[model samples]
Target chain A: MLQYVLKRLGIAILVAVTVSMITFSMIYLSGDPAIALAGETATQEDIQNIRRVYGYDQPIVVQYANWLWNALQGDFGQSHYLKKPVADVIFERLPTTMLLGACALIFALVLSIPLGVVAAVRPNSLIDRIALTIAVVGQAMPSFWFALTMMLWLGIYWRLLPISGTASWANFVMPSIALGYYITPAVMRLTRAGMLEVLSSDYIRTARAKGLRPMTVLFKHALRNAIIPVVSLAAVQFGFMLGGSIVIETIFAVNGLGFLAWESIQRADLPMMQAIVLVLSFFYIILTFLADMLNAWLDPRIRVM
Target chain B: MAERVLEVEDLCVEIPIPSGMLRPVQHVSFHVGQGETLAIVGESGCGKSLTSLAIMDLLPSKAKRRAERLVLDGDALTGMTERQMADIRGNQMSMIFQEPMTSLNPAYTIGNQLTEAMLRHKSVSLAEAKDRAVWLLEKVGITAARSRLGQYPHQLSGGLRQRVMIAMALMCGPDMIIADEPTTALDVTIQAQILHLLAELQDEFHMGMILITHDLGVVARVADRVAVMYAGQFVETGTAAQIFDSPTHPYTQGLLECIPIPGKTERGAHLGSIPGIVPSLVGEIRGCHFAGRCPYVHEACTAEDVSLRPSLDAGHEYRCVLSPQAAIANRNKQAAQ
Candidate 1:
């Protein structure tokens, strides 16, 4: 187990390095950073002076190395747009995004797993058909559009849940649901497929023959094994939600890092945007790494190999 | 005779395919009494396993099972609610399937699975359930029973897993057990050991056991009575001695002939075999199901479907146009000629 953990950590570090390189270059290499920093009206001499001051006059490689070195110590340059440290800007907004992402993930699992299990247990039944339809429809709609309509219908007309902004749990209801439903289809589909396969296994038949209640057999015998593959998938999905919550958060006014990312992009805030992408990608890598380990622990067959 | 434990009459299982409905098990009827072993012997895809599943009401969702009278311990089970059946299942009857490795859930420790049945059916405390699990583990011949309880199915060898499976079936003290080719996936030596243990446990508990297999030697060794299934139907059933010694149906005869008798078969000579495959079970059928494959292909054999006809001895029955005595005499005449 220790060896496995060590090997995973090695991979994690390699992935972190790769992600930081790509994010750093993608943001820095694309446009005129000096002009963007000094404004379009600046004279050539003024631009050159600004470039020298910000180290944009330096070679791209040197600049990247210097930037990476500073990032290692939590100084991702200053966010000129936010008038604060990049790390501080990101950390200030991290809590809201994490809360929304966590809520959405919980909602997705709470809804998908049972629906998937039911659909699998009684395939082609009414409940199965309804769940399938909901999943398919949810997957078809654009997230921003879905969020808009849901806000209109539930928050405006029905007056059930608050439409926009992160005021309270009620304020979270729309965006959380919008983001939750985005991944629910994939989770539900996998759960149903996994449940169907597990239900037919010889072990499940043995479980049934044991005279266990249908629910007991479905949950204990079938679900535990079925959820092994789904856990890894959920982890990947959860990672996506952390970063992918951008669209839903923007539409619903749930002030999180997603909104910050959009604002940085609009204003061309290079340092803050770079920090957001790098940290989010690093988080994505970490999530996937944890998911693989969780799967290995759950299924010993994979563990031994 | 011991009290009758399971009585299944005219059980039929049909699955609808794109072509039509496939009759996988049709008009199969048999009964098992306490302390008795009824081996349903047939080649693969001959509906032996389906018949066992039908008895347990565990048929796949696409397949439909119907029986005239499915009774266990004197209670009717023909249309029992899934909830009611749950109570009787595992409590009164449990099943052991082929491939013990795949029959035990990998995620659970052996103790959890073993105790689950007893706890589910009875109000036994967890401590009592654990003790029973240890006792059963020891009974199934596993050493270090208490420690073995903590291990998962993947930790055990195939032989030990099979033994654990058998022990699991006995957890709730079920009156009947349907072991579907329980030893087929194990090594030959392990197979013998498992059979011995299963027989010992069955005898000790006096449970009515239905052993489904294709091995004639296995049937000869363990079965008290035998039913020879052929393509979704039983063509022959009788006491094991009668089926082995005085087989009647042509299909049953062909099956028996396929088995090599040691020292009797000439060295390097081919053992007996039946020609042709089992006929398609789709659509309507007007004649004998085995007509295409039987060696004695009479026009009358295919003219009409056949039902099980009894011999002079009670319960000795077969599905064929010719009587057992007449078929034997006919064979004798052919030899003389």
Candidate 2:
């Protein structure tokens, strides 16, 4: 087990390094970085001076090495627009994004697992049909449109929730629903399919013949095997939630890393954009790694190798 | 005679398809006594497995089971609620299924699944359940039973897994066991070993057993009484010796002819076979179900419904229009040729 974990960690580190290299080269891909840093109205001498001061005149490999060295030390240089360290801006807003992502994941799992299990219990029954309809609606409805609908109903008319901001748990209600609902259909459909397959398996029949209570047969015998793949899917979806919260964050005015990304893109803040991409990619890689370990622990067959 | 453990009378199972209601098991009834093995023998798709499943009340949701009487040790099972039935199941009666490769749950340890039925049906502590699991595992002939309990299903071989299944069925010391094709999925050598183990266990526990299989050799060796089923109904039923010596029904005669008797059948010669597929049971079935496939099918055979009639031998019955003596004479004449 220790060896398997170390091997996974090695692969995760490799992916992080590759992502960092890509982020570093993105600024150079769009014409000259000096002109962009110095502004369009700057004279040629000012451009040359900016290039020299920022080490743009150095070899590309040398510049990349220097940037990587500083990034390793948690120093991502200053944001051109905010005139503050890029790392400080990111760290300040990260907690909000993490909180939103975690809550949305919890909500999605809590709602979808039982729905999936019930739907599979009696296929084509009333509750099964209702669950399937919910899954379809959740999949078809766009997140932005759903967000706006919730804001109009809950925030403007009924006045049930504060639609915008990240002040308290109440503030997260509308935004989390909009973000969490987007992935509910995928998780729910997977769980339903898995449960259906497991329910028909010979072991399940043996479990029934053993006269296990309905709940014990369903949850302990059936659901335990059915929930393995769902765990990995949830991990990958949580990573997407963290990175894909840009549109929802902007609409709700929750100043998280996604909002910071939007602001940096509009103002041409290259250093801040690079840092955000690098950080988000790292989170994605780490999450996938954790999912693999968890799956191995749950299923002994996978741990044999 | 030993005390009756399980008794069924006029049991039927119907399933609805697009065409019509499929009566797979029609008016089948039998009884098993303590320390006795009643083998239900038939070809594939002959409702042998359905009979056992119906007794367990584990039929699919769409299928319906109706029985005039289903009693276990004088307790009526027909009118019992599902909760009450569950208490009886795996406690008073248990089941062993075919396909040991998939019968045990892959995610659980042998000890967990083995102890589950005992713990659920009895008010036993966890430690007591574990000890029972170990004892049963050893009883089924597994070496190092204590260490084997910690292993998952995939870690064990198919034969070992089947032994574990047998051990699990005996965990609660039930009065009756319904094993559906228990050794059908095993290798030839392993099949004998498993059967030997099962017979030994039944003798030790004196539990009534309903063994469902399609192999005549298995029935001859293990069964106290044999019921030959064809197309949803029993064509013949008798003691093993009576059925083998004088098979009165044409279908039963055809089945006996299909096997290669040792030192009797010619070497490298074509073995006898019962031609024609089993007719569909989707609609109203008239006369004998095997009329179309029987060689001696006469006009009067298909004129009306055929029911079980007593043969010359006491306690032996077969479904046929021909007299028992006449049927036996025809089979003897055919063998003489």
Ten contiguous residues with the weakest lDDT in model 1 chain B: B328-337
Q: Write the per-residue lDDT of candidate 1 for residues B152-266, one digit (tens) a residue.
A: 8888999999999998899989999999999899999988898888899999999999999999999999999999999999999999998887788888877877888888766
Candidate 2 lDDT by residue in tens digits, A117-161: 999998999998998899999988889999999999999999999
lDDT per prediction? 0.88, 0.92
| Local error of candidate 2 at residue A219 (angstroms) | 0.7
Which candidate number would show the highest lDDT if scored against the true structure?
A: 2
Q: Lowest summed lDDT over 10 consecutive residues: which window, candidate 2 chain A?
A: A296-305
Model 2, A146: alpha-carbon shift in Å?
1.0
- Model 1 DockQ vs. reference: 0.67
DockQ of each: 0.67, 0.80
